[model samples]
Target chain A: MTEDELGGRLAATAEAAVQRLAAALGAAPLAGETARPARLLAAMRHGVLGGGKRLRPALVVETARLFGRDIDDGHGDILLAAAALECVHCYSLVHDDLPAMDDDDIRRGQPTVHRAFDEATAILAGDALLTLAFDLLADPAGEPDAAIRIRLVTRLARAAGMGGMVGGQMLDLAAEGRFDAPAAPMGEAEVRSLQAMKTGALLRFAVDAGAMLGRASGADAAWLARYGDLVGLAFQLADDLLDATADAATVGKATGKDAGRGKATLVALHGVEAARRRLDDLVAEAEAVLQPFGERADALVAIARFIAARPS
Target chain B: MTEDELGGRLAATAEAAVQRLAAALGAAPLAGETARPARLLAAMRHGVLGGGKRLRPALVVETARLFGRDIDDGHGDILLAAAALECVHCYSLVHDDLPAMDDDDIRRGQPTVHRAFDEATAILAGDALLTLAFDLLADPAGEPDAAIRIRLVTRLARAAGMGGMVGGQMLDLAAEGRFDAPAAPMGEAEVRSLQAMKTGALLRFAVDAGAMLGRASGADAAWLARYGDLVGLAFQLADDLLDATADAATVGKATGKDAGRGKATLVALHGVEAARRRLDDLVAEAEAVLQPFGERADALVAIARFIAARPS
Candidate 1:
């Protein structure tokens, strides 16, 4: 698949995710026998429906497609997984942009959820979104097999909970020298560990969740996890590189926050040149992980390259 | 059972929940490959381990025992479910005490999580606890049956999420007249709906979840759910009445917050005397719901009366 073809596929996948999410959310009763509060729904839509590349869902769908014999019919399970993953991603973004956390006013070129709604609503919106992710996974209509749904819940919760995303956020917050006791200056290994937990965990889960949905086992699951890890690392490196280099208009959120906050990131610990080299190496490592699947993994390889090459 | 026996039983149940919760939370890995952050764990412990009646867990244990053949050995499933529910309850207390929400400094005669820790940690602790609730339910060893675990997740998620606890909270917040656009005074029906969603939903789920863990059938589940509904209402009404009449020393938290905040509550709407009358009626309704179980439900009947009569 050429770059243009991958771009089109990515766009189409993102569109489908957005539509499914909107429909699913629309159909959701916010309260039992009561309409979902319009304001809360609006705040959730603002956080979620706002434009992004939808890279996480794309990875999920693409990974599932690798194992799917009939890709068309298999999309239901994959889409559900993808949508659930995106909910977590969006919730993280919403919470990460809170006044108490990252304090960012803009996300994806729009006001942050807290700024759009009130702080309490933003907090609740993020909470609701996170809860909804598990709800979506555990839905009988999503994954027919109870065992599969349970695995999804366990894995997704691990990835999104304290051990993964929330823990990473705490580490990141501590690194910012913001709390009563500023964390000691972090080294390269520490930064990597922080990034791995804070950012890489969910990205890794995205691919692994897709594989689970695909019913991939043994070597297939291991290879996809490896692919996800490398790509997740690469994605963060690319993001740090963007933070260091990209303009706010191009990146859609404030840039250079790492340097400004004195937060320890690989791009800060290692210079831009070294970080860029490492990102390239990771993309290569990611590609190598998929080599066993041959041409069937072309899109995933394209994804890895896209991670390395995307401007913002 | 006599009142004194019921008090001893409730105290024992509360103690078991506390011990189990401490162990479960201690075993929790705040992050993968890292000791759960000492401070975060401390904050979580501060929030959860603080003394409370632990009435929710008692309800879970008693409800589960209503169906258990060997009540002695069957505590594992019920305890897991109980611990998970308490986590949610504790998490709600932590967040609800935040400056952005209720802004209370004291809870159960101790500093609130945000008061003891920073706002950010309190938020994350609540988030972690909420996530941990689902994690506990999804544990392979907990229920063994994926279908059972999935049902637990589904029901708990609904009870805790926007349509249930969170949505009810939003309604309560809106009723507080704190927002720029203050909501009009809620009627008794609206207050009932809000209370049902906010406080009653989780309480309803507590009994229902206990029944699920006990493998109750259709009619049994329905009866327990109805019992939970009536008892949950009684619980909240009793709480409100306590808020109205009890001193800070007795209630442990600040009293008269509702009147001071102009919070729309049934106690405020119906006045103290009427609220007490309604509490008795609810306790009666709750007892009536358990009539089919006859003498086997003696403990539950005792529970309903205990709920109505317990001093702060």
Candidate 2:
């Protein structure tokens, strides 16, 4: 298949995977009947299922494919892991938009959860989603080996926890305006570090997790990890550039607002042109790492390009 | 050995297991490099290692003992699982004490994490701990079959997520004060339902997870689960009684405060005498379930008695 056709196919697969996950999660039995907590459940579902590009899940499927495994070989575990990642991502967005954090009202072209619900509900929903992510991985469907399942769960935890996403967020919060002061402008090193922790960690997890589900080992696993990291970095740089250059309507969220908020960004540090160039470099690096896999790497290559070239 | 002696031995083992787990987690390569967010690591440690009774870990070790498994079985997956349970337990406590949740200022006689750090930091710490719990299980620590590890992770997730602790908390929040209002007066049934979801779920998870670690199945697993449920309910009722009757200094935090806060409690719903009688009945019922296991069940029975009779 042509690269675009392959990319379209993978995206379709990811979409179906997410829909299946939602259905599966819905069918899970409640502990008992204690009035359902309708509002909390609604907020949790909204935060999780609100539309976005299923990049993380896509990476998982593509990486598994590259490792010579079809979707059916522990696809349930992969989808559950993907669903969990989405939960963390959604929770972060919800919390980020809170008054204590970024204080914005719009997210994905709709009122943020805190705006739709209250701050408490938003916070609880975020907390619930974060916990629910672990829950999803802990009890993946189709019953993979318990030991392997544990490994996948651990990877997600480390990626999403202090040493990863939360760490990046803390640094971002601390480094806001200090980037452009008498000191360095958040520098390539610092920006890269932050992006690696925040975005790359989870993306890398998706790739590594997909490999785990397929039981990939040795060099194959290492290559997928490298691919995940490269794609993750490119993805973030593209995001930084989009925030600077895209209109809010096109981006499906507020844009150019990072500068207004004094948040550190690649565009702010290295300029839009430099950020775009850097994204190209990352994409190239990612593609190079996948060369040994020959045609099997096609999906990964297309994904890297799609990340760097995405309109928003 | 007598039941008390067996219980004492098991408690000591649980403590040693926890210490070993702390060392293992501390020595993890991933724990290094605070070059990102030092506070997150510190918060995680403080929240996790902060003092509390290691009830869940004890349940794991004792249940494994009952199943005739050693600590080193499956290369310490059992230990790792135990540690992971503590992390989840700690995370729940941290979040449960949050301003938006329980609004507590102190826990186990120390300033609650939210009071020590900012609310955001505490929230992030709890989130990190919760994620780390699953991570610990998924990573290959011992020689457990991958399938078994996955099952354990799934079980933990179910207990800790929406249908378990989260569900119970929501019920408690919604049912506050209404338990004793003119309409309902929250009877034994409601209290049992709440305790089942809250305390019983995690305790049951602890036993089942330990059994999974030991590769126990069939009737043995069912008995352990039933034993766990009974013990868990007894533990909660004892807690409710202590809240009503113990001094704050002795309890190590606030006691008799639930009533003042208009929170539902067994004492509030059924009165102190009835609550005490119920505790006795629970202990007797729990012992009856253990009657089939003979000496192997002694430690569990002793633990149940301890829960019923603890002064604090």
Candidate 3:
């Protein structure tokens, strides 16, 4: 099949999986008495189902496929894992947009949660979503292996917590306004570390978690993990490039916004041409890691290329 | 043993267990090239071990004893679980003391985390601790049963999330200044619900998690859960009463402070006499739940009574 056709097919599969996963998560009894706080549930659903490229879920499903596991056989566990990651991502977005954090008024082409609801409710909603991520992963109905499931939880926790996302955020906060100065300009090494942690960790987690569920072991698991890390870094560079080059409408959120705020970004530190070259290098390195898997690795290879080329 | 003597012994056991658990958690991996962040690690250790009654760990031990399991056999998992709960509790205190929340400066006779660190670090520290709680429980070396471990994770998440602690905080915030109004003082039922969720959930999780780890099932597990819930509420009421009558030095933290803030507390709504009476009723109920387990349940029962009558 042509690359576009393959991409289309993968996209359709991912969409179907996401729908199934969302339904399963929604059916969970742990949401508590539905009648008492209907609005909270509504807000949760809205945030979870809101528009964005379900790239993380796609990575999970594709990686599982690469491991010779039929997505349909263990689809429930895969979806639950995807759902958990999405919940964390959504919660981060909600909190990031809060007045205390990034203070953005828009997200995913809609009014932010604090704008849609009150600030306190929005904060609580974010907190609820975060806890729910752990709840969904820990549910007994999905992923019966205790050790593997625990690994998944640990992976996501590390990705979302201080050493990963939060630490990167601290660095970003510290790097503001210092990017343009003659003294430093946020060295390439520092920028890479920041992006790898802040954005790449979760993406890598998506792929690695799916592989774990599929029981990939020994060298295969290590290979997939390395692939994930490389692609995760590439994904962030692509995002930085898009943020610098794309318009707000095209990105469906806000674009060129980071530059306006003096945030350290690949395109900001290194010019667009240099950033694009670095993206090419990263993508090539990611594809090289997948070479041993041959045809089974095609989807991941294509994904890296697409991530680099996508408009948003 | 007399109640005081029994209580003292259990308290000593808990202190020893806490020390052991901290040491186990502190042992760094020999292979890693870089050391973990010392300050962050210290903050986490301080937040967890800085001193509370260690009531949760005690309950875990006592519940395991009632199940005919030796504390030493499952001590590692129990301590990890207790440490996890304490982390959650400490994080809540740190965030709750922020200027936006309770704005308290003193906690456990020391400056609260936000006062000690910057507001941003305090926020991240709390977030880290919250995430670390799940990470600790999901450790493969500790709890081997994935399904049961998942259940423990889900239980803690629900209890600590919006429907539990955060929900209680919202209700308390909404009810501020209205506790003394003519229309119906914060009713007994509301206070019970708030305390049950805010404090009782974690305590209940502590006992039940220990029971689960010990492989207790059927009626024993159910009874332990009941015992835990009652004691958790009694503990909250005792805290409220102490806040109403104890000196700051005696409580080891600010006392009589909630009333000044117009926060709706059990003692503020119910007369001190009524609150004390309720505590007595709760202690009796808790002891009755433990009766079927015979003398093995003695430590837990005594702890419950002590929680209601402790000087601080």
Candidate 2 local Cα displacement, residue A266, angstroms: 4.1
Separate DockQ for every predicted complex: 0.50, 0.37, 0.32
Model 1 chain B poorest ten-residue lDDT run: B28-37
Winner on DockQ (1 vs 2)? 1
Sort by TM-score, best first.
1, 2, 3
TM-score of 2: 0.85
RMSD of 1: 3.5
TM-score of 1: 0.92
Superposed Cα deviation of residue A285, candidate 2 (Å): 3.0
Q: Model 2 scores what on Cα lDDT?
A: 0.72
Question: What digit string (tens of lDDT, one per residue) describes model 2 on residues B1-312?
Answer: 665676578677667766855674465347322243766666677777776668788778777877677676555556777888888888888877877677899888888887877676777777777777766777676425776766676677668766677767766765653222432335668777777777788888888876776667778788777888888888888988877776444673444455444456777688789989988998888888878778787777888888788776
Ranking by lDDT: 1, 2, 3
**Candidate closest to the true structure, highest TM-score:** 1
Deviation in angstroms for A127 in model 3? 2.4
Reference-based lDDT, residue A253, model 2: 42
Tell me the lDDT of model 2 at A77.
48
**How do the residues A121-221 of candidate 2 rate in per-residue lDDT, one tens digit apiece?**
77767777787776666664632555566666667777887778877776676565422243234667877888888778888888888788777877888
Candidate 3 ranges beyond 4 A from true positions: A1-43, A68-76, A177-186, A243-271, B1-46, B68-77, B177-190, B242-271
- The candidate with the higher DockQ, 2 or 3, is 2
DockQ score for model 2, please?
Answer: 0.37
In model 3, the Cα lDDT at residue B43 comes to 56
TM-score of each: 0.92, 0.85, 0.83
